[model samples]
Target: MTTLTTKLIQQSDARGSALAVISDDLSLTWRELCDFSLRCSTMLRDKGIEKGDRVALLCSNRPAFLVAWFGLANIGAVTVSLNTGLVGEGLRYSVTQCSAKAVMIERAILDAKRADLEPVLEGRTVIVFDGEQDLFAVLSGLAADAPYEGLGSDPLSIIYTSGTTGLPKGVLNCHEAFLASGRWMSRYLKITEADRIMVFLPLFHTNPQMYAVMSALEVGCTLVIRPKFSVSNFFDDARRFDCTMFTYVGTVLSMLTSRIKTPDRNHKLTRCVGGGCPAEVWRAMQERFGIDPHELYGMTEVGGWVTGNSAENYRFGSCGKARPDVDVQVFDPQDNPVPAGTPGEIVVRPKAPFTILLGYWDNPKATWESSRNFWFHTGDAGTLDQDGYLYFLGRLKEIIRRGGENISPFEIETALLDHPDIADAAVVAVPDPIFGEEIKAVVVAKRDFPPQDVRHFLEGRVAQFMLPRYVQFVDEIPRTETQKIQRRQLQENDRGMIDLQGVEEHA
Candidate 1:
């Protein structure tokens, strides 16, 4: 009963003239957004896109992105959200792997990667936005009405995982799950129509999409969209838009703390809802900006949040208690429940069906492997206190969390090995004060290679976040008997082996 279509319709009918979305160039009311979405949906249906078809959306955080997203959902079509930072092989692999029938991309992205996208765009519908000929022009004369026959359990979006170990897997999320997430956030965060939510994170990720965008739509609140996160203008933007609440991830809090204190820092902002709020920075933010930081723990696979710590009932280093509808427990490797305060894998079971991820798209092996024992196993190590408060310890998977982005060591190693001068490589996480973790690469090279040269080689091959911060060349890399790279050993031994500051200086 709580499908996205219903949420939009209800809001438009009730608050037709309320401001719903705001960006630098455009602002739309609830009625306008609902009407535009209907026209967009009709446009897609005219192009032969039917129920259950996959349509890829590759654009930055903008009004066009939201229009396309809602339009696809209106007609029961699945959307494959592509990260705007992706390029070349990574971009091609995502579209091809999902078997996207059509792609809607921004003109700037298309122009920059026309050569890389040519092969993937062949034999598929490609619609360009933010250009001379945009989606607005195409839907100018289209009817502002479309049939909504979607059920709550139908698939809504396919978000690709952050390829931490190998290739990225598409995580399928349903309408029911998304609606449940927004409802929970709306109640727990106490968000109301008067709240102005600032959304600076990428729209492709679940954090910004669910916590910021969807939650705003559900409550008929004004959503202030940003192209991307900006450290220098973060507080300025919030103050400029009179934002009441904002979401964050990674080192956004830490970066803000490092800035010089200003008198205008204390603005209309009152509440902060996000994960990865380090304990030190968490305290600093509240003291500096007069805002309470509510840290929570969840992932893309879980469909929404699992645990959250609010200002009223928060522990310094805890992620708070699990929701009433979710069964969250810490279990050992053998699947037995671990004692309180013991670190183990965090697993979850939703009380209602279709309130969590349906499964990984096109990867039954991963779906079955993760959801074994009737509980979806989260690849995160954490502990629950006696009071039911969750404390995140670390990642079970060998992925690096750099500034809130997941960087896969295997992906970096594979790219490093592509260089003729490098014979072997192993990537590991190094502790950092601001970013939480920075990447370090230990390589067995054929000859001496400058760190800058290696970075230049990986510029277009991988995302900017995946690039290594420190490079240490050695004669050989440690390996197991089965010829597996001993990453844990490398991580432990390299603590004092390389001068990270010197490497940065030279690079």
Candidate 2:
């Protein structure tokens, strides 16, 4: 039930001499990290940051990010981790959404986002951290003090969603929820002090925040931080850090498999974890690297693993079984639990306390809407097998209803990704006069080719009804930081497409 700050102090006291973090050539021992974090806390307190204050943290993936984050939490200030990739309204909305008092941004980020940020942070305290020197010099002349005592359920972070269509909601998460997820990750992945957890994912996301940061502290292991995911240097970085475990964002595995890099089987890396990977990519990684990429289903709201695949218990093409302490069920439109293998909205409820989010920041209506029939509706569509294995079916809103049948874009996208000539693809529903909605496929191809070829390619592979009605070629498909397709952007994009069949492929 201890908070992240308390755990940091405990790790500092017990293993002060142990290496805790490594970012490039520099490294931090437990003691130094704790001392710097304490200094950061003292400095922030002096800057008028008080308990219950929400501070926007805009920074890159570095040790300083952790220091500032822990420092803020130490003083009971909520860390509003904004996505660095967000720009304009998406960026401004995140900062002002929770009435954040200060915007602690990296100088580089501030310089780049000055236009989008300048007006919003006019009166707000804009604390900027450029690099290690700034982080180290924080509370420079002030004495280090113990962290403020707080309950495990105290708000620690407010993670905002990627608002593509609408303003992103700030997810209010507490210490226990974050740590519990970390403990589960540590145990499920079989992490130990000897294992180095490599975090190449964005720090703003749940995987790195909960799995990498919290798991490393829970097990007193070293955290190997990278600025970003690099295809060429991934294995090299792993071997250099002696990292035994690494986490991915579903797309990393695909990227690694797609690239024609030299055989990288000889590394300390073993366990790979995260979700969004197709079965082909999952198997490709296993066959090529001998590491099973465990598929774990989670999000900003749940703050923990709703379903996961591990070595002991796993199912190919499924996002594992519901976590032992979490009740994951699929419910129909009427709010009744659907039978196994029936596609419906994935709803979750924690059997254990402090595992789910406190609420969607200040949006009680959104929270209440999510908590329908005592089960938190995830808004994503999925199904549970008879054995309780969960199969993801994309977002419920993204499910296209042509005539009466609901078609999932994920399966079509996964199929499209298998095309050799096609580099990337996304499926969306277009307005149709007859069928109500028609399936449209937007593709990024290696070379120009007839759009009908795509339909011919999927002839027998997918259901006839699942074949896309329109095929559009695009220069690139926009994706989120985690590499998820930006479906909304595609829906808003004007049509420069070829209609495949003038009729729906209804049997």
lDDT of 1 by residue, 1-507 (tens): 556878898889988899998888878899878888889999889888888999999888888888888899998999999887778898899999999999988989899889989988989999778732367777778997555867899999999887434788999999988887787787778889999999887888888888887788778999998887787887788888899988887556655765535534567998788876656567777777877788898888887687887545678768888877799999999999999988788999998878789899999999999998999999888889999999875567776889998666755665675676876677888888999998888877678756666677888988988887777777777753113366766777754345545666775
Cα misplacement distance, residue 237 of candidate 2 (Å): 1.4
Model 2 regions more than 4 Å off? 502-507
Clashes of 2: 0
Among these predicted structures, which one has the highest lDDT? 2
Residue 108 accuracy (lDDT) in model 1: 91
lDDT per residue as tens, model 2, 14-53: 8899999999858999988888888889888888999899
* Per-candidate local distance difference test: 0.81, 0.86
Model 1 is weakest, by summed lDDT over 10 consecutive residues, at 479-488
lDDT of 1: 0.81
TM-score, each model? Answer: 0.80, 0.96
